[model samples]
Target: TVIEQYEFCRVHRKEEIIISYKIEKGYPLHIDFTILPNWIKSLKDELLKIIKGQQYSEYHVDAPGYYGTKGLAIILKTLTEMFVQSKILTTNLCIPQLLSQYLAQVLVPKTAIRLIAEDFNNIFLDMAKKIIID
Candidate 1:
């Protein structure tokens, strides 16, 4: 009844990790993920194949939209966003080989993560703007 134990794919796990980052100053990449248990791992591979093969999964992103595939979708979305941002920012920012060091010593450690701890000021500002505009 192991499958029965999982109320939802991945989310059914007793633990999940939340990663934080500085979105504006720079969404520095810091992967804080744990390996899935063997039981979940087994099911994930087949499910992942099916999910990735979908042509327009977003078209079906509605209620009850592949609940079993939510975890895979979320992981793909985050990585796509991060890497695409990285590509644009690296070229525009003109950061040299010291990218990792710069992200670590300068951005992440600066102000003791004050900006990050603030839940990103820009996001709040955007929400406020949307509310006012609407």
Candidate 2:
């Protein structure tokens, strides 16, 4: 089953969208990510409740030490290191927005994006193949 397919456009940073890709478009796509403590403590339980309600139902982080959300914990970790470097420090969403644009443009191009999409499609096809084989 194709779960969802969407295109991300960088209107402000228009140069970022090289190609649209499918993040995950099939069943058995494991979105179950790890959790972190820093995000939980900093963002708080209220935020977590909201996230869970939105179907981001995974938490693989220890509390009090990391204090970060599972999916975004890596970003948080990087941001903290940047803060230590005397860079701009704040709860600014602009950084993330720009980073998103970078991913759309620089990291994931049309070919790469298409590859990932095909991968998802292949997963579904393989599952069907397996059922037939069984």
Candidate 3:
């Protein structure tokens, strides 16, 4: 229902993306990154390997209220950090820690959000390089 509606609104570009879910009594919450780009998906796979067991599920018990929020904020924040570290984006342009944390409840959901964010940052960096060189 919510997913279908979100898809519909997304397809039409009529509304900002919003995810809603209920925490099942025994089931662990999961974030679906299917709508994100392929690079994000691949990065997620890689991060999952590197991070070992520090996945989204580990944060569930600690931050049950954040389950409904989109992982976009975390993704963006990670990308900003990566860019700053690599000098692709200036440190001055980086998002403030307070604001970034406020936007995304968790900073290190390394399995999904962090990986996806890094992928997006890489894609943006590549595009920026191409544009600057061309």
> Quick one: best TM-score, which candidate?
3
Clashing pairs in 3: none
Task: Put down candidate 1 lDDT per residue, 5-120, tens digits, no spaces.
Answer: 56664663432322221233333344222321232333333333333343212111222111124433443333334433445224223244253433233322211222222333
> Model 1: which residue pairs collide?
none
How does residue 61 of candidate 1 score in lDDT?
20
Give one digit per residue, the lDDT tens place, for model 2 in 1-134. Answer: 23332223334234233112112323223333243224223333333232224323222222211111343345444334433234333325224436444323322221122222333463453343332222
Supply candidate 2's per-residue lDDT for 128. Answer: 34
lDDT of each: 0.31, 0.31, 0.38
Candidate 2 residue runs with Cα over 4 Å from true position: 1-68, 90-134
RMSD, every candidate, angstroms: 18.6, 18.0, 15.7
Best by lDDT: 3
Better of 1 and 3 by TM-score: 3
Q: Ranking under TM-score, best-scoring first?
A: 3, 1, 2
Question: Residue by residue across 3-106, what tens digits does model 3's lDDT show?
Answer: 99989877766322222222332212455545433434446444434323344232321122232235454455454454334554432332443434422333
